[model samples]
Target: MTLKIPLENSSFNLDVSGIAGFFGGEESFAAMSSVHLVRGRRWLGWYNSPGSYYVAKKYGVLAKSRVWDGLYPGVNVDPTTMLELDGKVGPRYVAAHSGTRMEKTGHLAYLLASHYSDLEVDQVIPGPSAKSEAHITIASLEEFKEFEGYPKLPADHLSPFDPIATVPIAFSVGASVMCAIFGDWYCFAMIILGVVCNGVSCFVIGSGVLKIKQPNPSPHSPPGDGVLFNAPGSRVILLKGSEKIISSITRGRFFLEYKSQSQYHDIGYSSVALTMQFLLQLFIVPQGQLFGQIMFLSSLGVSWIFNAYLASVDREDLQKRILMRVLLQKPTFRTVALPKWTSLVVFAAVYLQAKPEGTRGLLEQLIPNDTAVWRLVKSAVVEAVERNKDPSEVVAERNLDHLDNQERGLLEDMMKQASIGYNAGNDFKL
Candidate 1:
């Protein structure tokens, strides 16, 4: 005999709105499960199969439908995955699953049946009621307090006074002012050199400096409060470990400062050499001599070698190595060790090329000091003038008499062609 049950029964309804979007269409949602409005509050949840309702009911966790909108309930949603619960339903509420929110039963039974089997279902128990616990809507459970809004991006930093850039600019402007006052191209070259050097140095050095250091978490500071740095590749900030940071920062300062000083030295050397060349051309060097030009240009070359030697010293900075890795855009090997053993060879070469060989004055180094030979040449020229003969011809006959026949013939031919060309140029001018 079948026992007749009353219309009023222990039941609840579970809404499956959250999982509705996942279905391809209403047919898919309807095919998955059926939801019907029963007469009383009954268990309403999605099930994998038609028989899952009996399994859930046997474990005391109800999946059987109660009522929805006071209509006969039918299968409409299946047990997919429980997302979360929404607003309250009547006076009592049950745990949600497969994006299902049930009302009436106040315990989490769907989570148990899904997670644990019948043997382990006893271990599962209900947690604090949703109404009893405080709620927080946060993006992340970790570090919830610190996140206020969208994080601010790091800003580009610029020093109030950069000696490397400022010094060169000052010199260039000074040269411009001097050019305006003195009205000479020498000053213009000086100014142009300064400006060019400044631009080049900025490109090379400033590029490295411009990449800002990312905020690294400090060991000493509270978690989430990152370590700060004054500039990219700089360790001016005293981090937790003092000894290491100090040494690293000192080395970085030395490397960048050494570079700046070397550039300044180049600018000063060029400016001074140009100024001296200008003065010598006006008062001492009657014409630009090939030997004089060679010696002067060689000195500048040696100065460049000296600058290279100064820069070649290995000064390692930890901060700079990290910055280099970031700028490369991918993980790379650590800073390659500089071959400092070759520094001795560079030093010797620089010294040999730059050092003066003998007790030669500055002017004598550039110009020949053969006073007696010049005087003899002058006497030969005077005798030729008195005898009404060409000075060049007389000089060659007297001073160059020891030359062989072939050498004499070659010299005479060169002189004849040079004289003819000079005459032609003079005629053209006239």
Candidate 2:
């Protein structure tokens, strides 16, 4: 039986309307495997395939259907692959892609970045390309999703099981997130394997699309120079009628990089650790309990790695940007267009909410085994800045120096720095 996707989103009413305009023809995704593509109007816009559109949305790209031509081979992009923003959306951040002002998916990217995001975000970067200029900032994830034309989500955004390749990786990421919150190493391991499996999925998807060769080349539309139509030994980056070809290559690169980032998050111990985690979870005895921990740890590690890697891709959030901005003055984390820090806090908080098991597990680590009230004092010191006192003044008033000798002492320096903006939240922007 074919799957049916429901429409619950009125959020992107404008975008849906735009889509409806071209949806003169109803298309049945009876053959389409991805749930996001179940049954929707077919149009020239978005992706030609329902699966592609579904995957794009899952990866946090709302307008990804339109931005990417189709699932092409050799392209390395993923949802985790971040888009680094340079300027502003309207009066805020400017956007660019492939050296051009982002017209496609710009709004979608902007909206995603603005909503459901984390970090002291500065910019949003599109995936796979290492090119520095290919990024833009829209707003924090929270505000972006609520933007004027954002689309409504269907039951928190899900993809159907098919094309086995992507399923594992996507599941890995999703599961890893659960692991982090639940401290399940086995689940985490599953996440690692799943991510690699996703790379394989990308390959399958790319290859499948790549095979759609035309019987006879149209002599009229001479192919442009790109990776699309390389006649095996040809040197010219021949761009051809292979919109599908370019898309395949694009798809390959995307998954490749996404896999690479997974490894990168693994810090070059890489997929090797993933293999190890999978082995441990699979072979180790107690089966259920430890296996779950393995999964959680694996997932947590990967998820954190994604965040840290994104911090690199979105270098504005990297140490360089954070430090430079901190050096010049106080740092006010910018969330594309909306209130800064809102996204970062919300992202972390939401993740915490989603994985209550993991969040509770992490609480044990956060709590000092020895002292409780002192950690409380440090918190008080951190909050003091909000009281509008200077960092020094706040520390002194709270007698936080007493914390110097306390067990949580090391946190003092971190608090001191963060406290600089204790009173500056309203003033800072990325």
Candidate 3:
């Protein structure tokens, strides 16, 4: 957390002599962080995130066929160092700063090893040893142009470009204009993904909204059990056919996810709207950075909008519903018309006996009431303390010393209260 940037009384000064290539991509990943000399500012430096996870994962960078890792955050880190002797005294050309987490030492040293192996180490200014901060300074880099002809990527290998920080660096390092590979992450794609994650989660949980009657139903339609999932309007996972619900798949709750001509129109419209809006954002962001920032901010509003149904199963109220679901499955209350007290006990048994893992989101629907969760957790802790026997012995041993103290009194009260509460009172001598 020691953000070493342009802060007041910073101990060391990190200077690079050689650096080249793009700078804009550096600004995009981290918007505010830059190499500018501002006194007293907490800077967020890239710690240890790999390009493999963010770039190689199917949903992340590899979502697009080809991706440019050059889309830098802020700070177009010059890989090379400079010397000030004459009028043309400045840094030599270098590549963009790849992310942190290299093979050995933590900072972004891997980029130099992977791409620019030709540059011999003149002098390296490593970061703080005992402390977290680091500052690397390269003396000079000897570039090999025909090291292997031209690179598949045309931009400078030494300096990568930032997204929003797309501006080229000043004349000091002789940095060139940025050339980035702009694919899907522009603006619209993210908006659509955000809306989808939020929207779907909400649609499943929102009450009353899911009450649209089944379109095709017989006079006495069989009851359905489990959830329904469809991908791109095509049925994917049908919980109605779950083996858990039915001993045989034939008895699964029957539901269909096929979209008719009517449903397709709405789906298409929504899809088009999402794509269009995303494109408009991509188009606008490169021009209006603040507007792009606003768009990204606004999307978070609906992030949780669609995940309501996920909560329902996870909710504590579902435990009650589950009991009703389980008990009602046994169609037998056969000829008994009266039993008021028995019903209450039957209801209470579900609360006392239900397993915690069997009911996962018990915390979701709970509202800090006299819910089962608190009672269960509290009871387990008390039971452990009782089994340990230290509380009672400690309280009894010290009763004469400070019986009136609040903490001691509480411990004493708890021992008295728990003795009979768990039916641990010794009785049978046998």
Candidate 4:
């Protein structure tokens, strides 16, 4: 059987028959065969035959296998025997297998659509096209929306304010003012501490803001009660308890909550208190007063610990959401401001504190390794390390191919649209 997936300008024909040897009646045959086929295709690695086996079994194929023999290392298998199973399977097995394969293909299409362009999958029903052979029809975004569970195309919402990037510039100006006014080591140290606190605070606060902006329903609030207001203040989607909205919001919420926090209300309180205390010291206290300095430093320390604890708790919350989303075969996305400032600050911090060159080791030491925030920081370090290596070594390590002309064009178009929307939003703000 062949699957025809529609793209922006053309269609992609997936020759399932070409990979028929990868699927067989026996669990071992299916598992090993698929691993071999997708060994180097890291993006497609998750769709290996063993994963398909469970999917097929769920649809009532090979119901007798109770023990879950997970994916195995690739090995040579009899191609002819696998082909025989594909061709000679009984009607029940054939139907189950077809359903399973189509489901997997649908998932693949969804992933591609999310990053590249909107796409849809439809089984070619018998009629005029029956003579053409069984195939999957890729539908346009408009056409795809008719199907169940498929979401609306992401809105061109302007990305969020980058507190991280802006805060550092603000801090530098403030530091210069202190240097001119106080001209002491204590003032210099306070400047450093303030910048560090602001950077870390901005990172977690930006993540929390993005989480709130995500097109997810509030767990505590009922459907229709939750409103998703996008960045740049252009779009608002009122959510309802309907399957479509709930499913989309639930998937999105699960991920957002996992990477950040379920709700940021408590964190907001802490931030407000810290900000107020800092302002009090800045405006009212004498510059040389040790008591005011102590109070400010103590508050900063407490805020750092509080934010770190929240970040760690958010990581645990995310793990639970991930398990739920995986089992449900659903995830979601939303377009919000890019939070460029936050990203810049976080990246700067990560770069300074990465292993072997711990210029700002305090940040690393403060953040727990187990937290999601730290994991992101680690990934950034690894990416930077990879870029510094030989070009050939980096290419080999990633094994990623350059996008073709068609894909490149589509991606460029998507980015351009986003850029235009962002600029427009900024203009409105100005």
Please tell me which predicted candidate would have the highest TM-score against the true structure. Answer: 2
Count clashing pairs, candidate 2: 83
Superior by TM-score: candidate 3 or candidate 4: 4
Q: Candidate 1 — which residues are off by over 4 angstroms? A: 1-160, 163-165, 204-430
Arranged by lDDT, best first? 2, 4, 1, 3
lDDT (Cα, tens digit) per residue for candidate 2, span 85-204 = 112231111111111111222222222233223334354422223332211122211100121212222321222222332332354566556555554454444445534533433332
Candidate 3: 10-residue stretch with minimal lDDT:
78-87
lDDT (CA) per prediction: 0.24, 0.28, 0.22, 0.27
Which of the predicted structures, 1 or 2, would earn the higher lDDT when compared with the native? Answer: 2
Q: Which ten residues in a row have the lowest lDDT in candidate 4?
A: 90-99
Query: Considering TM-score, where higher is better, how would the candidates rank from best to worst?
Result: 2, 4, 3, 1
State every prediction's TM-score relative to the real structure: 0.17, 0.22, 0.20, 0.21
Tens-digit per-residue lDDT, 51-114, candidate 1: 1122111211112223221221333221211101111111111111111112221112122111
TM-score of 1: 0.17
- Candidate 4 TM-score versus the reference: 0.21
The true-versus-predicted C-alpha distance at residue 18 of model 4, in Å, is 74
**Which stretches in model 3 have alpha-carbon errors above 4 Å?**
1-250, 254-263, 289-295, 301-430
Query: Which lDDT value does model 3 have at 66?
Result: 20
- Residue-by-residue lDDT tens digits, candidate 4, 1-430: 5332123133332222222112322442222222111112112211111112222222121111222112122332222222121112111000100111111112122222222222221211222122422111111111012223223111122122223323324434454354434433443444444444333333333232111112443444322212222121212222223333333322232112213233233333323333432443343333423432333333333333333322233322232232223322333322222223222222222222223233123223222344443343334333443344321232234422455666445433333322332232223210
